[model samples]
Target: MNALNPVFYKEKIFSAAWFRTYGLLVIGSFVLAMGYTFFMTPYKIVPGGIYGIATILHYKLGFPIGMAALCFNLPLSLWGVKVLGKQFGLKTFICFILVAFFADGVPFLLEKCGHPHPYDPFQLQDEVLLASIFGGVVIGIGVGLILKTRSSSGGTDVFTSILSKLTRKPIGMLQMIVDSSIVLCGLLVFQDWKIPFYSWLTIFLMGKVIDIVMQGYSSDKTFFIVTDKIEEIRQYILVELHRGGSIMPVRGMFNRTEKEMIMTVVSRREMVTLQRAIYKIDPQAFTTILNAQEILGLGFKRLEE
Candidate 1:
């Protein structure tokens, strides 16, 4: 939708809800980057992209990490704007600047506390595997929130998007390949393959978490129950589950006996309850539950009404 579109101009975009979402993304990105600088970088666990290079520089040359990340990402982000499109580029630029600024500020705040802990307890510990999992979760939350706002924390993701467009390969596979190369570099320089391996783990988990957040994690199922107790089945489905269904008359394919066919859609949790209700009402109910790729109606979220 255009910026001027009614939907785009909805009050929600400027409402308290929008501010909350933006605040979460900013804080989450800052905390995750702090985790890297204080714990992951001190121990030399490079994950990849601008953040990976920032960790390396922080460990080797004592460069300011937020500055390093911002500098490194600037050129790539500019390239993204030139190549990707205006909207994507602008959003990413804003997100990157915010992350860089906050990441740089976090360490100074921690030092002021005189905790001597040196690391963010809100983040993963010094352990490589835990760092990968927790760092990925934190960053994924940041990225996912930005995405919900039509923004991105510019990094290798932009490069991957460009590469996927040119190569006609799946974005996931292309990202894996590009990120794996960075991990290889870390391994080659440090001579510790475990670091690179854990970095890859972080990349994998981030992909999964971002996908779940962007698309939602709800799984749905469609059931087709063939039974003689059509009335009981309908009552259980409509009343107990509060779901709508359709019943039709049919003849058995083999026995040529008349039968009633019931079709319904439900979430995963509701599917179990429905099945149990069917079994209770009619033990011999022949039911077939199929994975529904798409459903559109009152109970489900649909692209079109």
Candidate 2:
């Protein structure tokens, strides 16, 4: 698709959204680099990703983490390109290259510019917990930005994909297993049980932060109401909440009575009002509310362009 339609992809890559996405990617890359160069690596906190392997290699075999990471990521990045798609390949390549340079170059740049890598944090706030939390949040935002754009920098992302394909497992489940394994490896390799705990904390927080960054914190509750007083409920929703929804026919399994199910999506705050209104109208209303990560339409944000 990218090869046959360069103009579309080219213009898309240079569009405002593309600019924002890549800008976020750059900032995220720097943050990820800092988490490794300053926080995780310095403290030997291997919280997965390519840097996780790089950390063990750096300490055990005296490997240059930057080059090691580049070496480690090359094949996975290519694999992402081969299997995922060209756009993903391009973005992943860009992100990986930027991170490779930043992770190695940031400290040198800072030292050259006058402020050397501060040792105060290393000495004073050297707690594994601190490293885990801060590093996770930073890395989460970084990875979230890359993923929000539907791009990746390979590493375990590719590993997870491969495992999922081979094992017929969900990508998320496989990713979790792989990340957990990295933490466990840290525990075994370093012989510190705390490493696994802290690493797991990082992984958990990182996943949550990634969810929040990409999905946003604003949550919605979608309700499917099976009630006899459809008009009353529908009217209240339309007039009170200024929202519209669909009504469909459904039969009560136990009673075998025909009924209408009102399906509506509303923000969390609106849930209370909706429920109360429904209750006032039909006290015996059978309502089921489910969490909505996103609701894009008339009342919510428009679909991405």
Candidate 3:
């Protein structure tokens, strides 16, 4: 095996990545809970998942939303740990507790700060759409941040993750199915078709927001470069970029000459460095670049054992 730089391979206790993930989780949980407490609950917008169901119960029996969500998500999170492994369990458990804490705490703090009814406009029966849009955007960002760490907020996320492992199906679509079921239940519980429509709208907006927050407008880029100086370009990619790619044998359509096609994926920032190196080595190299929606491996995800 080729030896890797120790500095490149090492992870320190004081690493920025660790602190960033934890910081996002804490902030995401608080923002998510705030959306639930202030916007979603007062308007009865069941945008899906365990929290949606908990909201229904909160209205019916005057139960605490946070406590209800914790009760449901705890078992699901444990089951997810058994499937996904220990690190996932730890992160998910943290998300669960923090969300539950903030869900209850935010309202208490708000009242203590002298705003006894902060979202009172929602209770007035005219701002349902506004509440749903704002609530969906905030929760979508929270969920996206949690997912960025490769950890979930449990509930239907766990179910979809396990199913994705087994069936290799799209987790987003699977989650939509689960959330749709909850929306259907909301219809029955509230006996209002309007509720389902509003909930559906929120769900749609939330998905768009999640996609934007997770993938960004053009965060990832894929490059396909064809050059005569293939060896030099390949070495630069390996030694400097520290990234791996495969060489594909190709026949030029016009010349019928055999050639090597170099293909790689990189972040937007990395693409600039790679392009500069390629141009310096082979000024007339043919290159194509495209946006990459997602890539899993190496720097992106843990390698499979």
Candidate 4:
């Protein structure tokens, strides 16, 4: 029984992790679908990716946006596997499928319930700009959640990767080129200048929101201090601040004098306290401070998380 305890706990941990990942995927897919069904599609905003093309088809040919995106995704995914020799994996396939189901199903249910405009149930037609902004934020949050699980909603990224391989262009550049072409297609189809502008705005906001979600709002700062009074500062950091840090030997380029440099990370408030203490300890100390976007280690966020 004692020997089996570790194995039992490991299984429990694995099960919990699996459940958490898939739960996030489901919630992310639903949120992404809501952003499209309510905020984006109704406004005729093409924010780029497979969904952007699907939006155009929905308006032009009366195709269902979610179904259209899936149709494009399937072939693209297969082609990607052939050319890139990379598997998108089951999680990615499931994510896009869930997005499709929720995207189409919700609107259909709304229509059956006798909503005046099933797509724009909130009547956001007159508020296109607001719709674009909120749509980006919501979509960003959804994508961020999906990404945290190391899965993706398989789409144009696969196509872009292929293009990158063929052209030997950077993947990031190819992605921009492909997305831009799709945005231009929307302009030509809709013949509305505002559509592209609003779509670009949505794209920009989504990118910003995604970064924020991934890194979180940082309140930690990193400090690199070069001082002759190394012992004084080291004691203050270890004893007073109760923080761990690294100390290294350094040589001044101007004076050719040997010195010690201390590197440490602390919270915003603690940074201020340390700054004052360092000033009092050594007025001539050279210090550089930088914002720490994410810190995962002892006395910070857990490595597992």
Q: Top lDDT: which candidate number?
A: 4
- Candidate 2: list runs displaced more than 4 Å: 1-13, 79-88, 116-124, 163-174
Residue range 161-218, candidate 4, lDDT tens digits:
8888898999988888888889999999999999999999999998898898777878
Reference-based TM-score, model 1: 0.77
lDDT of 2 by residue, 133-209 (tens): 88889888888877876678668988788767778899988887888788778888899878878887888888899
Best by TM-score: 4
* lDDT against true structure, model 3: 0.83
Tell me the tens digit of each residue's lDDT in model 3 across 120-203: 424646778888888888888888888776677877888788888888999988988889999999999999788888888888
What TM-scores do the predictions have? 0.77, 0.85, 0.68, 0.90
Q: What are the Cα lDDT values of the candidates?
A: 0.74, 0.80, 0.83, 0.89
Q: Give candidate 3 regions above 4 Å deviation.
A: 1-11, 119-125, 162-173, 219-305
Off by over 4 Å in 4: 1-14
Clashes of 3: 0
| Model 2 lowest lDDT segment of ten | 116-125
| Candidate 1 regions with alpha-carbon error over 4 angstroms | 1-21, 119-126, 218-222, 226-229, 246-270, 280-305
Say which prediction, candidate 2 or candidate 3, comes out ahead on TM-score: 2
